[model samples]
Target: MTDRIQEFFRQRRAEGRDLGPCLVVDLDVIRDNYGAFAKALPDTRVFYAVKANPQPAVLDLLARLGSCFDTASVVEIQQVLATGCTPDRVSFGNTIKKERDIARAYELGIRLFAVDSEAEVEKIARAAPGSKVFCRILCDGAGAEWPLSRKFGCVPELAVGVLEHAHRLGLVAYGISFHVGSQQRNPRMWDGALKSSAAIFRDLAERGIHLSMVNLGGGFPTKYLRDVPAVKAYGQSIFRSLRKHFGNRIPETIIEPGRGMVGNAGVIEAEVVLISKKSADDQVKWVYLDIGKFNGLAETMDEMIRYPIRTAVDGDEMEPCVIAGPTCDSVDVLYEKQPYLLPVSLEIGAKVLIEGTGAYTTTYSAVEFNGFPPLETHVI
Candidate 1:
């Protein structure tokens, strides 16, 4: 956890404020992150991904920074609009959108959209005529913490056909986009994706269609339990890849960042509901918390993602414990497969602050499941 986070929790505890399962966002950190990315990629346009942490405060701040928005739904588009952002600054980034949602986005003045298949291209053509569309080409999602595979993005050939169909159907074939996946760690992975994009641009040029934009969908990494390279490193690698692939013919570049921008800016404060030892001989203690998978930490599925947790319990000795949620569901277990150690003196009513939770927590939480209220977010 960052020093600011530790200090924030310390001050909250000093003030005796209720921190019950609340997701706290530090807007100043978010602003610094945005500024860092903007400085690193001076030539690239940033459209903050709305699906990460769509807190109105986040959107409002980015809007004031002159950042565009990458919205995945009509509600997200409306949220960006409510921040007084111009329609052209919002890109309907979801490739698989409902027809009515497309119409509504168009009605609200969203001109840029993302599409992956010919059918979706046709849907956009019919629903939002003359709209500019970008085709999402498939990537292997290598070196990414969250592999967004099989659900979105099409093969390059399919994407080419989709762009062709979009042009034939009277919609503007504006650009090509691809996601390297969420929490992408290896910056070299951009090489192949950019090469494929270059090939598509050449193919489109052969067909007398000159695409003028390239949307590098979000895969930027954030500091979690593991360390990642600095944002400047990612920018340097991307610029090198663009030069290697497109040379001087590079199109207008855009990056859609979700977790990379907000993951470290937030933390979740939860209370220990109970501690149980299955039997007298049981070595692993079950530490139950008020927040769990169904509540706001579903990213722990299969133990792929781990959040750094801190506790107020003070001691020199620590012991490995099994952390589980308060839910009765068997799958609510958080760290049974992985080692999670807390102070040996930790007990019920102790507050545990989970870091690197800003982006995925509130957005992915279930609403009022298991008689517990949904995760509440507090932006500072």
Candidate 2:
């Protein structure tokens, strides 16, 4: 474990704390990350995706930082509003909101919304008349950790039709939006999405519809098991793409960063419950933790999201072990196919820390499953 993490736990233990499964968020790191994005994209508006970490402290801090919010549900909208942020600064980024929720958002003074289909556009038109809406175009999701495969966005042609339909329905079809998917590593992914967006812009202009904005949607990456480029690099790529595709006519830009803004600021501390071999002559050592997939680490689906893990035990030699979560579900195994290395001296009751888990853990945890409580959280 890193000295800082060890010292954090050491201090807690010195105060006679129970070292159970808990998520620790460093607010300072989140602040620094917000500053980095602001500096990287000077004139762009940031709508921090609240689905990343809905913790009150996280939302309050971002609101105090003068950041807008990208809310997905009515509850999220209420949460952002409770922080004293106006609804105008919020975007209903989810394209799947119900008609009642749409009307509720509009009643709350939110004018910005996202749409991906004709049905959604019609619903928004009736529920939130004259609202400013953006159409989401499908993405290839290349080099992204979480590739959205036709689950949310539409084809460019379909998006163009959707926006036109919105305009006909007395709604302001302001711009286009697309997600390169979460934890995107390749900057070229934005290039293609931007070029496609530009094509849509031209098509709309040909029809005498002038748009004012373009939402890049969040896909910014954070460092984890693999190295990721700096926010500045992503900024450069995005600006270059905008310049290349839209030229001097680039519209107002917006970013809705969720993982990139908070992923690295969160860490989960768990305890080892058991260590043993599954069978005789088995070369693999199995280590079980108190936390698992349903508890909070649901992002480990298919082991695609790998978190950097460390044990409190210190040793000169390390051995690989299959980590599992303490759940009745057999699928609670965290790293069975890909063994994680830990000190051979690791034992039951040792604490393990999982780094870079701030974004998806809490929001995705089961409320109460397998008799395990929801993941506990602490902010620093």
Candidate 3:
């Protein structure tokens, strides 16, 4: 958390305007993050994933910084364009899309698309003829907090056929892509994916279809409760893997960073709604906030993402507590399998600060769920 965001919360409370849970994002932090990614991988392009956080201010800032965009839908493409960014700088990175959406994106001047199946290739060829198409392969998602595996990407052997089919159907077989996973902590994970990509590139070259780029899909992690490696470390490791696999002919490369780009730039301020225990002999207290899975903190599902929660009573006597949300749904629990440690003095009406939440919170928030408004966002 930064001083500016703290001051914002303090002022909101002072004015009695802190009526609900809200997210505050520091634009200065985003600007610095963009610079860091650009500096670390100087040769690679940065495509800010729109799905992570599609705030208009965030898009406008990244556009001015010369960052490209990776959009998942036609609406996202339109959102990026509304920022005065040209369509050429945007990639339709979602492998699964409606044919109409492909036609719409093509009409909007989006020539680059992602595909993992011949059926998808056919749809693109019919709707977006001669567009550049990259094939995504599956990874095991070994070390990521949010593993993105089965829903997207084809096998490497199948990707060859998919790209070749695209070539025959009048589409440009651009290159290969794969996501190691989201919130990936290990820098070495890129090596195995790069190796597979190199093999695909070579196989296609023999068939007279040379590829030109490698979409190093987003897996870069942001600091949460556990510390993560620096972006420079990932960049260095990826560069080394590129050299190892492709020798001197490293293909033109790009990275789609979602969490790593803006995750640390935001914080959430929530109010402790109630604090109670289930039984007289219970040692754990249930602390409920106004926000929950249906409202904002969906990433806490399956207890995969553990957010750092801070309150004024921190640094006092601490104990394990079951953190929950104010909603009536039984699934509104935030942390239960692994109880969160909070100060024993924490009480109702206390304001809590949740850090490392800029990327996923606002976008994941539900609309009017349990009559709670969506997570309010302020880009400072």
Candidate 4:
């Protein structure tokens, strides 16, 4: 760890007081990140994915930073609009199926949406006739960590048929969109997404159809205690491939990055309530902590797993300790292995301030079975 981080941790611990398990969003960090990302794409426009964090402050910051939004639901759209962003600047990027949702977005003057199937197109045609739309094409299943080929997005082979359906319905099929899944380490992964989009656009052009926009869906990760692809480098790299395939004369290039935007801006502060030692063997000891799979680090498809932890908010020095969460279930664990601070000792009332929780930390915990109230969040 850097000396500055260590000093920050030490200073906070010395001045530490009492606060409940709360989440803190460093708005300054968010603005700084926004500025950096914005300066990188000097010519192109950006659409921040609202699904990532959706803090109104974050949305307002994004608008002020000169980025639009990629909203999934009417609630998200309304949230963005409430931030004073025009619907034209916002794209309802998720696949629209329900008539009520579609009708609401159209009623609110939302123009562009993602179409994955004929059924969705038919629904949109009936619900919001003439509303401009984008067809989401399937990514070639090569480099995505979570390849969306099987579940959502239209298959490349079926692009013509879908576009033809849109034309037949007299709908303004305005563009195409594709997601290369999340935390994409390989910029080359976008090569497939770019190729698929260009191929479909060309085929559609052959059929005398033209599109005006292209939404490259968001998954850019914020470098929170780790470095992968810097957004600037990734954006430039993606743009190069994009220009190569579609040339300079193409539709508006839109990228929706969610986690890449606000993930580094927040951390969750939790009070340690209990500590217990589990003995798998004499040499194997697991230290249980107060936080668990619920309040933080809960985004697991099936089982809860802790990511490699870094510096805590308050660490005088480094020590080896295992962290676990406070829940009735045995799965309420923060780390199963590795070294966290032991604080020279363990006490019940001590705290753990976890970083990189800006995405899905608070109300992100959705469970009614345990009868737990939602987490309280405060921004700083």
Whole-model Cα lDDT of every candidate shown, in order:
0.89, 0.90, 0.95, 0.69
What residue runs in model 1 are displaced by over 4 Å at the alpha carbon? 1-19
TM-score of 2: 0.97
Better by lDDT, candidate 3 or 2: 3
In model 3, what lDDT does residue 32 have?
92
lDDT of 4 by residue, 1-380 (tens): 22333344455557863344555677777787777777766655788888878777888888887788888899999999998888899888888568789999999989877888888889889988988878888765454333444566878868667877988897987888888876565666777777778888888888899867777776666554446777777778777888888997756878887777777776655666765555544332345544456755575333322333332334554456656666677666555444454554545666566666677666567554255445556555
Write model 3 residue lDDT over 10-111, tens digit each, in one string: 999999999999999999999999999999999999999999999999999999999999999988999999999998999999999999999999999999
**What TM-score quantifies how close candidate 3 is to the native fold?**
0.99
TM-score-sorted candidate list, best first = 3, 2, 1, 4
Q: List ranges where model 3 is wrong by over 4 Å.
A: none
Candidate 2, poorest ten consecutive residues by summed lDDT: 1-10
Tens-place lDDT digits, model 1, residues 1-380 = 56666676778778988656888889888899999999989999999999999999999999999999999899999999999999999999998899999999999999999999898988899999999999998899988988886788888988888898999999999999999989999988888989999999999899999899999889888887889999999899999999999999878999999999999999988999998899999878899999999989999988878888888764547888999998889999999977688888998998888989988889788877888888978887
Question: Which candidate wins on lDDT?
Answer: 3
TM-score of 1: 0.96
- Clash count, one per candidate: 0, 0, 0, 5
